[model samples]
Every structure is written in structure tokens, then in C-alpha cells.
Target: MTERTAAALRVVNAPWLRPLIFLLLIVVMWDLTIRIFKIPPYQIPAPKDVVITLWQEGPMLLREAWPTTVATIWGFLLSAAFGIPIAMMIAGSRTIESYVYPLLVFSQSIPKIAIAPLFVVWFGFGMLPKVLSAFLLGFFPVVVSAVQGFKSVEPDMMDLARSMEANRWQIFRMVSLPHAMPSIFAGLKVSITLAVVGAVVGEFVGSNYGIGFVLQRSIGNFELPTMFAALVVLALIGVVLFWILDVIERLAIPWHASQRQDVFLAA
Candidate 1:
């Protein structure tokens, strides 16, 4: 094998090593920056202190994080349930597109945090508001991506399907739907991360639970290490969620062009 092939094999076989090394490098740099500048812990706790905090408070953090994780997943599922059908509806007809598309675009322009309070008012101080926040953040991307995916089917393929006496539903099922998987998956990857952010924003605004609430409390109390630790857990949640989606995408659409490129890059 060529050197490129060997390097690709290493990455494929030892997937965790490179990321771990990078994490260690970041921790080292973070520690060095604080030490070199004599920065105080209250402003930016050292990595050692952060690590200690993480160990000390891991159980409590995990308990707080559970609600946020649930809200994130529930919101993501709701967005997917609504977004795909709405996208198909919009894509299926010009009348529907003209009526709904502009409103969707307008909603996207508004900052999520600005409208989060309204959701709280409508849904009250419950998980519903957080779920709605996550849904609002996640919904638009799926609609856009699914529409693109549906419309991306080649003209020649459509003609072939028509010639073969395929109905609209049949054509969509066999060609358009498959063609759209990669794009849908792409939207889902983005939406999931945004869902996490949405949940945190909701928690920050009004909740008495979640890692985000813990973070806010830490900030108020000036517990820099606890704040840093909460942030670390939040980061891990996002990374793990994104990775899970990526894995699912690869498994679901292994024949997609992007997946083929990924395989080529890997080996």
C-alpha cells in the first residue's frame, strides 16, 4: 500500500486515537495559556482544577444533564416528524409553496433566543417550551434539505420512471426518496446540534434543571471550576450527539456519493 493508504488505514482502524491526541493538545495549550499569563482561576480555571471539578461533581452534573438530553431528543423527533411531511407538501405543489415558504423563511430570520420567551408563555414553564424551542430551531433546515433532495432527482430518471408506468408515489418512493436520503441526513445532523443548543437556551432562560441551569448557577456563585466542568459536559453531549447522527447517516445511506467519497478517503 501507498503511504496515503497506510495513513487512511490507521485512521479507520484507530478512530479514537487522533481525537484523543487533539483533546490532550488542547488541554495542554489551555493550561499553558493560563499559567504563562498568570491568569487567575476565578476568571479561567486551570485544566487541572476543571478536571478535579468534573470528577467531584460528575454525578450531579449527569443528573442535571438528563432533562436537557430528553428535551433535545424529543424536539429532534418532533421536527423530523413535521419537517419531512411539510417539505414534501411544499415541494409537491406550487400553491402550497407560495403560501408557506415565505413564512418559513421569515421565521428563520428571527433569533431563537428572542422568541424563546414567547414559547415559555404559550407552553408555560415546562419541557414543552424547551421542546418547542428545539423544534423551531431544527424545523427549517429539514424542510429546506428535504425539498432540495426531492427536487434533485435527475430529469432522465423521472422520464424513465414515467415510461415504466410508475405512479407519482412509486417514482418518489424508488428514486426521489433514495436520492434525498443524503440531504435529509445532512439536515438531521445540523438539526440535532441546533436542538441541543435550543434546549440549553431554554434552560438558561427559565429552567431550574439541566446542565445549562447548573452553568448559570455556577456563574452566579463565581465557581469557575464548576462552570468550566458544566461546559465540558455540554460539549461532550454535543459531540456525542453529532457522532451518533453521523454513524446513523453512514449506515442508512452507505451507497450515497458522499459515503463513497468517505470510504475512498478512509482506505
Candidate 2:
């Protein structure tokens, strides 16, 4: 390999160096912008101020963040649990797809926030409503991705499998499902992020617990720093969730094109 290629690989795989550098750059730019614009702390706190806020509010946020995280995780799991079967049915039968696809599209088109109150009324203000909202947020992507993935199986591969006298289940398990793993994972990653948003939205409407509830209360009390701290916690939750999904994807489908180190190197 060329020296230049080696250097690039070294830099990319160093991990901490790049992230640290990026973070430092962001902090410098943020500090500079805040200083130049003289933006008030109430309006937009500086990185340093936010850090202080995080430290000050850590104990309270710790108490609130757990319930929200739990809700997000459960909602995402439920979405996957229900969505995968529906997607499989749709992919396996054109009749089902024709009947259900439009409904899926219509449901997606409807603004979720508009219907959140309805969910609260139907399911009540307990964890059920929040989980349902999150499930709604995560539902579409899994189905869509699974359908596409199943349909994307190469015809030649299917023909080869058929020649081997593979049964329908065998064809799906060996060919279609494996081929679609990347797509399924793509949808899963997107759903994980949406799950956090859904949980927060659920809390926003009416809830006695969760980070979103704390955030609402902070805003009501005009506690800017606390709000900022809550936001940071939300962001951290999202990052952690995404990372966990990424790890799972790697474990589940290490052979997928998306997991290809060569692709990463080329990019």
C-alpha cells in the first residue's frame, strides 16, 4: 500500500484523536460565536456554561433520564416486534402490500403530534401512551426497509435456490432475509432516533416523570441552564442508543455491505 493510504488509515482508525479534534473545533467556534454575538445565556448558553449546567444539574437529570430512556427503548422494541411481521407479510404477498401500503402512507402523512393527545386519551397518561407514541414514531421505517430488503433479493439467486428445491421458507431465510439485513438495519437505526423524539413528545403532552417532563417544568420555571442541561442529556441518550444499534447491526450482519471496511476506506 502507498504511504499516503497508510497515513489515512492510521488517522481514521485512531478513533479518539479525530473526535477530540472535532469537539475542540466545535467548542472554539461556539465560544467565539457567543463572544462575538454577545448572546445571552438565557437565549443560548456557551459550551462552557452548558458544561457547568450539566454538572450542576447532573443529579436531577440522572433521576429523570432513566424513565425516558426506558420508554424510548420499549417503544422501539415494540415497533420492531410488530413491524417486522407486518413487513414480512407485505413482502410475501402482493395482495397484502396493495391493501396495507396506502394505509401506511396515510398514517405516515398524518402529523404524529396532532394525534398525540388522542393517544393520551385512549391509552391514558401512563407509560402505555408514551410507548405507543414511540412505537408509532418507529413503526414505518422498519416495515418499509424490510419490504424493500425482501424484494431486493436477486432473481438469479432465487432461481438458483429454486433449482436446489428450496422451499419458500428456506428461500426467504437463506436468500431474501440475508440480502435485506442491511436495509432492515438502516430502518432500525432511523427508528432508534425517532424513538427518543417520540418519548419526549409523549412527555411534553402530560407526564409526571421522564426527562421531557423535567424539561417542561424547567421551561415553565424559566430555568435556562436546566433546560440546556436536559437537552444535553437528550442528545447523549440519542447518541448512546444509536451506538448500541450500530453495534447490534455489526454483530447481526457483519457481512453486510454497509459494514464493509473497504467501503469506509474508499469513502
Model 2 alpha-carbon drift over 4 Å, by segment: 1-13, 261-267
Give candidates' CA RMSD values in order. Answer: 3.2, 3.3
Off by over 4 Å in 1: 1-13, 261-267
| Candidate 1 residue pairs in backbone clash | none
Put down candidate 2 lDDT per residue, 121-195, tens digits, no spaces: 887889988888888999999999988988888889889999999999999888888888888889999998999
Q: Please give the distance, in angstroms, between residue 165's alpha carbon in candidate 2 and its true position after superposition.
A: 1.1
Global local distance difference test of model 2: 0.89
For residue 2, what is the lDDT in candidate 1? 100
Residue 126 miss distance in model 2 (angstroms)? 1.6
- What TM-score should be assigned to candidate 1? 0.92
Candidates' C-alpha lDDT? 0.89, 0.89
